[model samples]
Target chain A: MSEWSKNELGQYEYAGGKEDWEKVEQIASLCEKFVIDEEDELVSDEERSCYNCRFRRWTKSAFVCMRR
Target chain B: MKIFVGIDDSRRLDGGGAGEIVSLLTRTIDEKGWGKSAIPSRHRLYPHPDTGYRKHNTARSFSAEVKEQYMEELIDYACVMIKSNGTSDSNSGLAIAVPERMDNTDELIDYAYRTKETMINSDEALAMAKKPGLYIFELSGNGKGIIGALAAVGLRMTGNDGQFRGKLQLGTGEGYIATVKEIIEKSHIEQVKNMDFENLGTEESVRMGEKVKVVLLDHQYTLMVFPTDRQHPRWQTSTTNMLRIF
Candidate 1:
């Protein structure tokens, strides 16, 4: 949803930190391209969460969705 | 002689991960009789924006048993494997360390812990790589991956860090129950301990959780179980939430 905003680099970064599990899971659950990342890179307990999406890039505070 | 090999790749659109690359390297060495290698373990680094690898802040490493004469051959194979697999935009680095030749391993371990908490540059990593028994190389891109490659070897040296890249299939599936002895015999897990670090008896029952995984602890593949409400099988494999600590 609108929880994501584009930064100056024209990348869509999650508004909150990585701990916003509910939002990320909901977003990933809706996205058609939510491919699971490598098992080693997974952070969230949810298997299909955006935090586990291969296209999401981690920043200092939050993550940017490269697929966006 | 024993050696540790580590590699890091800063991949953006690449379909596969560096773990697969390093895992292939491990298998190749074993297949070639160059060494006997275990599965690769994955290490996490600081994800500070300044570090520049926003795609994935992770590295992979594995330990091997090899003859001292094969060190050069091993390094050459690693360089070729990494260079050939890396994408044009990927920045990859490889690090190999021989603990027997190092003057101080604790210092290297300290650097690994620091890399997990802060940003480290290529020059600093390269400087550390100049140690007597360590070798590091930047295969592509901006070469910042050397930081992670060096840190991964150090982290693996700690003997209590990182998780192996894949899962261990000891049981049929989730909710499968087995005793401590059975779990150990079925997989490479060396020890079965509860979350409190207490050792479980051979007869103690453990219920496999949604995912069965192991972590490197005390230089062994340790399967850590968590307490559950069930009485018959009170212990179960740890979940991903509980395992992210590694």
Candidate 2:
């Protein structure tokens, strides 16, 4: 169900842009490695969403999951 | 006296992000009765390819109203905190600006804007610190943090940059509607503006979203909105994607 592909930097970038709130929350719910980021860094309303994960590095368009 | 504190950290820094450090500093300031601090803002620097940090390229700053006699004590305490919190391999730095003591703040702001645009050298940050009105200190590592630290202070001074540290707890559920006036009183946000930066009238209604993030614009705490054309409310809180620009 995940559509992750390697970006030019060799990091796994999410196909979904930063606003896919529902999709990101679903992914984070099932992700075993999900860890909450600092309070100031949180973007998603869902505390457990991938957007709140500490391992996700923000890119210009989307974010790269560093867990892989 | 109004003073602004800016702090930056290297990617591999071990203790915490810049925001965490600022939060600790703010707490310390109030707990020690030095001064009252405001909410810290997170400023996004240009994500240049050459600058790979341990985390995101964001710095944190906050303004405080401290007593004149305790100013030196506050700065010294902040330096000590950064030293104890940062690891040996981490590069962390801070800049403290006293508006009254500094005359060349316009230059500092220009330097801050440039740091956000391109790669900056520490030497440039050091040179700028030599001028009056600003104090820059390198806490740890190779001292690569001066650029971001100075940029944080400058951007905070602009009164038009950075996102506030946390979201506003306006209401439960995302569909509740509130006018610009109501939201302002509830959230302490001074103004409501659309994505284009146009001011929303006091009577203008907005459908609140899950995350009610506030940004700094025109020297005010601003809540951003966009037209949704929904039946209940004509506007909705701007999504975080839209807020990435801050």
Question: Tens digits of per-residue lDDT for model 1 on B1-246?
Answer: 888888885654638667778878888888888879987999888886744325587788899999778888989988988888877877888988899999988878999999899988788888898888888999998888788899999999999899987887766778789998998898898898887888889988898877777889899999999888878798888888788778
Specify the highest-lDDT model's number.
Answer: 1
Pairs in clash, predicted candidate 2? B11-B53, B11-B54, B102-B133
Consecutive 10-residue window with the lowest summed lDDT within model 1 chain B: B48-57
- Quote the lDDT for B193 in model 1: 83
Task: List the candidates' TM-scores in order.
Answer: 0.94, 0.84
Winning candidate number (DockQ): 1
Tally clashes: model 2.
3
Compose the digit string of candidate 1's lDDT tens values, residues A1-68. 57888877888888877788888888889999889988888878888898888888778778888888
What is candidate 2's TM-score for chain A?
0.92
lDDT of 1 at B68: 79
**Residue-level lDDT tens digits of model 2 in B102-147:** 8777998998888777778899999999898888899887787778
